[model samples]
Target: MNLTSAAMIGRINPEALGASTLGLALYNTCLMFGIGLTAAISPLVARERGSGAVATTDAIRRLVHAGFWNNIIVVIPVWCLLWEAAPVLRLLGQESRLADEAASYLHVMQWSLLPALIYLVLRSLLAALERPRWAVVTGVGAVVLNFVLNWLLIDGHAGLPALGLLGSGLATFLSNLFMAGALSVAVAVDPRFRKLRLFQGLGRVPWRACATLWRLGAPIGIGIVLEVGMFTAATALVGHYDPVSLPAHAIALQVASFTFMVPLGIAQAATVRVAGAAKRAASARAGWVALMLGLGVALASAVVLVTVPEPIIGLFIDPSEPGAQAVTRAAALLLGIAGIFQLADAAQVVLGGMLRGLQDTRMPMLIAMFSYWGVGLPLAFVLVINNATTGVWIGLTAGLFTVALLLLGRWWVFSSGGRRPPIA
Candidate 1:
C-alpha cells in the first residue's frame, strides 16, 4: 500500500517517487535484522503452546516479553542505520541527489522503527496464537490509514502544506505508530490475550530465552538480508542507468510485491499451521500442501501479469502521463519477467515459512546466501552490465528458482527422516 502510494506520487513527481522507494528500501533492509529476530516469536509461541510444558499463557507471556525486549535491544543499531541512510546509500554508489532525498525521508521515517517492531511482535504473537484475524483487522486498518494520510499529507490537502516524498515517509511513520498502539491495545484489552499478562512482568529480561530467540532468529534475519539485499542491489544497479530506470524498476518491483502479498499471507498461515502441526503427520506433506496453495495463487497472478502487463503497470502510473511511456515499457518488461518466475517466488516464500516453522533457519540461511548472493548477485552484476534492467530481473528470477529448488530438496530430506523436532 505504501509503495502504491509512492507509485502514485511518481505520477506527480518522479524524483519524490524515486526517493520514497529508495528510502523505503533502505528502511526495510535496515529493519530486516529486527524483523527476523522477532519472527522467532510466532514459531516459538506455537511450539510452546503445542507442548503444554508450562502453562500456555505463562510460556507465551515469557516469549512475548523476550521478543519485545529483543526489539528494544536491536532498535538502537537499526535507528543508527536509518539515521545514516543517505551516507550508507552514498557509500554503496547511489546517486548523491537521490541519496540525499532518501535521507531526508528517512530522517522522519526512523521514528517509527520502535513502534513498527513492536507491531511485528504483536502480529507474530497473534498469528501464533491463532488469533490472526485480529492482526488482519489491524493490517487492513493500517493500510487504510496509510492511504488516507498519504492523500492528505503528500499532496497537502485541506489547507496543509505539500510535503511530497517526505510526506509519504511521515505517513508511513504515523501509520505504523498507529498500528503498534492499536494492536497493543487490542491485545491488552482482549480477553484471550489478557490472560497472558504481556505487560505484567515487563521488567524481567529473560536473557536466556532472548538468546535462544537470537540464536534461531538472527539467521532468519541474515537470510532476509541476503534475499532482500539482492533486490535492493538490483534497484541500486538500475538507479545507475538513468532517471527513468529507478522509478521504472521501483514500479515493477512494487507491483510484484503487491502480488506477493497473497503468497506472503499464505506463507504466514503456513508457518503457524506447520509449527502447530509440529510432530504430527508428515510435516513434509503439510508443508507441500501449504506450498501448493501459495503456488496456485501465484500462478493466477502470473497469468494476469503475463496476459495484461500494461494494465497492471498502468495502475501505478497512467500511460497517458508525459514521460510515463519509458517507465511503463520498462515496468512491463520486468513484470513479464516477474510473471515467469512468479511460481518460484511463491514456492520459496512458502517454503521459507514452513522451514521457519520447523525451526530450520541455518540451512535455509546457507541456501539463501548461496542462491541469492552466490548465484543471484553475480548473475545480476554480469547481466546488468550487459543487458541493463532486463538482465537484472532475469538474474533475480534465476536466484528465486535456485533457492526454491534447494529449499524444496532440503524439506524433502528432513521431512523424510522422522517426526523429530526441527533442528535449531
Candidate 2:
C-alpha cells in the first residue's frame, strides 16, 4: 500500500493527499484496532479468580470465544465503510481525476479489509491459546499470497487486463480472503479450538470480565492509535513537504514496518507472558517475563541492522526505479537509527503490554500523550517539517526515548510496592 501510494502521489494534486492518507490509515486501522483490542484475552485469563479448578483448555476456549465476537465489532464497519468510499473520499477532499481513481481503489480494497480483521482475531486467539508457531506460519502464508497476487493482478498478467491501483486492491482483497479462510480452517480443525467450540458462538464470559477487557484493552487501543498515528503523522506531515518526499517516506515506512515486525512479535510475547504470570499471581515474574523478552529481541534487531545495514535496506528500494533514491535515503535513515531506537522501542512496547496485562492503561495513555504529543509532535514539527529531514528524526527519537522511560518507570512503581493485588 505504501509503495502504491508512493507511485500515485507524484502526479496527483495536493487536494488528493488527505483522502489518500486517511483511507490508507483508517482502512489499515481495522486490523490494528482489532489486534489491540483482542489483546484483552491474555490479561483476562491471568485474572481468572474462580475457586474451583477449571481446566486450562476450558479457560482458553472461553477466551477465544470472547475474542472472536469482540473483533466483529471492528471488522463489520471496515468493509461496510468501503461502500461509501467515493463519497468518503470526496469528504476527505480529493478533487479532479485522482478523486475518482482513489475512490475506485478504496472501494475495491474494502473487500479485503474484513479478512485481515479475521487474521488478527485468529492471531490473537492463538496468542491467548499460547500458540505462536501456528500464528507465524499463517502470517508467512498471507505475505506470500499477497505478493504473488499483487504482481498478477496489478500488472494484468496471465492474459488478464491490467487493473491499475484498483486491480492492486482486488489482489490485496483476494489474498486476505485466502489467508483468513486458511487461518479460520486451521482453528476449526485444531484440537484446541474444537474442544471449546469457541467458534460455535460467544462463550460464557462474566460481565465483570467483559468490563475488565475494555478497561485494559481500550487505552491500549488508544495508545496503539497514538503511537501508530505518531509515525503515520510523520507520514502525513511529510505529505505537506515536497511531493516526492511523501513517496520516499512511503517506501521507507513499509520497510520499517517489516523491520519493526521483530519488536512487534516480542511485544506480543511480553503481553502474553505478563498475562500468564498474572494468572499465576506472580507480579515480579510478570515484570521479568516482559523485561527478558524485550532484552532478548533488542540485541537481535539492533545487532543485525547495525552489522549489515545497506544490503538489508537496499533490498526494498530498486535504484533503476524512478524516484528510488528517495527510498534509499529513507532506508538509510531507518538503518542509521536502528540501534538508538529499538532497545527503548522494545522496552516501551513491552512495558505497554505489561501494563495491559495488569489492566493498567490510563497511566500509560497519559505518558504516551505527553511523550508523543507534548514532546514528540512539537519537536518533530520544528526539526523535520520546518527543516525538511534535518531534525525530525531526532525529535522522533526523543519522543520514543521518553515513552520508554516513563512507561517502564510506571511499571516499576506498581510491581515494586503498589497495592494492586496479583490476579488469581
lDDT of each: 0.83, 0.63
What candidate 2 gets wrong by more than 4 Å, as runs, is: 1-23, 49-52, 55-63, 77-103, 202-212, 278-282, 303-309, 421-424
Residue-level lDDT of model 2, residues 291-391, one tens digit each, is 77776777677777667766754544445666566555655665566556777777788777777766677778778888988887789888875666435
Indicate the TM-score of model 2. Answer: 0.82
TM-score of each: 0.95, 0.82
In candidate 2, where is summed lDDT lowest over 10 consecutive residues? 6-15
Residue pairs that clash (backbone atoms under 3 angstroms), model 2: none
- Which candidate leads in lDDT? 1
Residue 273, model 1: lDDT of 78
lDDT of 1 at 270: 80
